[model samples]
Target: MVDPLLLQLAAAGAAIVGFGWLALAMDVHWEQAQGQRPQPAPVVRLLRVLGSLALAASLGLCLTADHASMAVLVWFMLLAAAVLTVAMTLSWRPQWLRCLWP
Candidate 1:
């Protein structure tokens, strides 16, 4: 079995990446990002695909990391971390998000 901590970190990474995909899918967010304009349709589509994949991977990480109950806790905790990271990044350094999307 995988280390729970490692799985937690992976989950966090996935959430962040998923957030990037979410950001890429939005026009308004792009407009506000540092030097980033709206992406083309193909790019948006790609982002959607990647975002979904990342989120799914996060779930997989959690489930495989531990038993069901522990996995649920770790997964949700990592998700919260990911959300906080995204929110903080968007608030303080949206340019960073543009870097990911662009």
Candidate 2:
């Protein structure tokens, strides 16, 4: 089995990317990050799929690190953290998020 700390860290990364992708799928956030008006339909679709998969991967990693009961709680906390991080980044420095995709 992988080290719990490593797995948890990976989970955090996946969650952050997941939320970031979800935010970028939105026109406003995409414009903020991409400096454009409206994202392409195909890119939006792909982003949504990738975002959901990343979130699922994050949960899987969390489960691998802890008991199922605790994993759910931990996943939620991680999700919250990821959301805040993404939101703050988007608000303050959306260009940083460009690295996530571009």
Candidate 3:
């Protein structure tokens, strides 16, 4: 039988990686639209890289979590991450996000 917890962790990991790519793409598009001279902002780039690393670590931790309940919580967090991605894609309207997130 397939382990449900493993499946949940795999889904969470995929979601995190997917969002990381999406964020990178959005950053590129935003920069291109600005039409400013492309200058690498060290601090901002460092933060984004660190954030991606953190998400990868979270994925690892989620996969190793032993408790089924913890897996469920991780799944919920993954869902929240997906929702946040959608909200960001939709221009980050406060009211719509507040209804679901707050």
Candidate 4:
């Protein structure tokens, strides 16, 4: 069986990566991270799909790591943290997000 703590950490990482991908899918955020380049439609769609899958993976990891109620609550909290981390990274230093897409 997978270690619960490891799974929790993986869940958090996945949530962050998921949010980063989703943010980069947006025109404004994409421009911030990868300036002057034309945003490709196909890449945008691919990023959106990958981001959604990562989020679902995070939820799955969370559920596997804990009881149902706790897992839901923990996952919600993880989402909040992930959103803040991505937003701050975007505003403070969006170039850092390039790693997510590239």
Candidate 5:
């Protein structure tokens, strides 16, 4: 049987991470439009990292507490991580991206 609590937690985590990404994107764009460098603030960076970790933990929780399959968990985690990566890429310059990515 599906554990309702696990499902609720997973959904909440996903929503939080998704909204975080959207906010990051909007902030970056707003800064760029105002003729400012679109660098991520320290708090934003911390939040991104924390959000990624939380999403990963949420996936693990779902896997353990519910009947979710391994494949589903893996894909969901990967997708969440990928969104963070893409946001980082778009919000920073090439040198910053290289330093972070490489």
Candidate 6:
């Protein structure tokens, strides 16, 4: 089995990167998908898929490190961390996370 600390850290990193990929997919920066820089649809699709896969991997890592009950707890904790990452990014970097529209 993998070390619990490693699993936990991996889970947290995966969650954050997953959220970042998702945010990029939606072009939350506005500058990424608009007139001066129109991102390709395939790239956006890939980002979305990667985001999901990363989140899934986080759960897999947690499950590998512990029993089912502990795995479930870790999974939910990672989920909460992921949500917090998104919220904090939106709150702290509103300029970087501007809507696609005006």
Best by TM-score: 4
- In angstroms, how far off is 44's CA in candidate 4? 0.7
Model 5 lDDT on a 0 to 1 scale: 0.52
In terms of lDDT, the best-performing candidate is 4
Query: How does each model score on TM-score?
Result: 0.84, 0.96, 0.35, 0.97, 0.40, 0.77
For model 4, the local distance difference test gives 0.96
lDDT for each of the candidates? 0.78, 0.94, 0.52, 0.96, 0.52, 0.73
Ranking, TM-score, top scorer first: 4, 2, 1, 6, 5, 3
- Please state the error at residue 83 of candidate 3 in Å: 6.3
What is the lDDT for 21 in model 6? 69
lDDT of 6 by residue, 29-65 (tens): 4344243567688878887898899888888888887
Predicted candidate 2 versus true structure: per-residue lDDT over 1-102, tens digit per residue: 689999999999999999999999898899899896557899999999999999999999999999999999999999999999999999899999898778
Give, for candidate 2, the lowest lDDT window spanning 10 residues.
31-40
In the range 1-102, model 5's lDDT, one tens digit per residue, is 667565656655564454344444355433543345554567456656655665666566556564667636654765666566556655664233322211
Looking at model 1, the pairs that clash are none
TM-score of 2: 0.96
Q: After superposition, how far is residue 52 of candidate 1 from its true place, in Å?
A: 1.2
All candidates in order of lDDT, best leading: 4, 2, 1, 6, 5, 3
- What local lDDT score does residue 47 receive in model 3, on the 0 to 100 scale? 42
Tens-place lDDT digits, model 4, residues 26-60: 99999999998888999999999999999999999
Q: What's model 3's TM-score?
A: 0.35
How many steric clashes between backbone atoms does each model show?
0, 0, 0, 0, 0, 0
Worst 10-residue lDDT window for candidate 6 reads 93-102
- Over 32-60, each residue of candidate 3 has an lDDT whose tens digit, in order, gives 33334353566346546654664565555
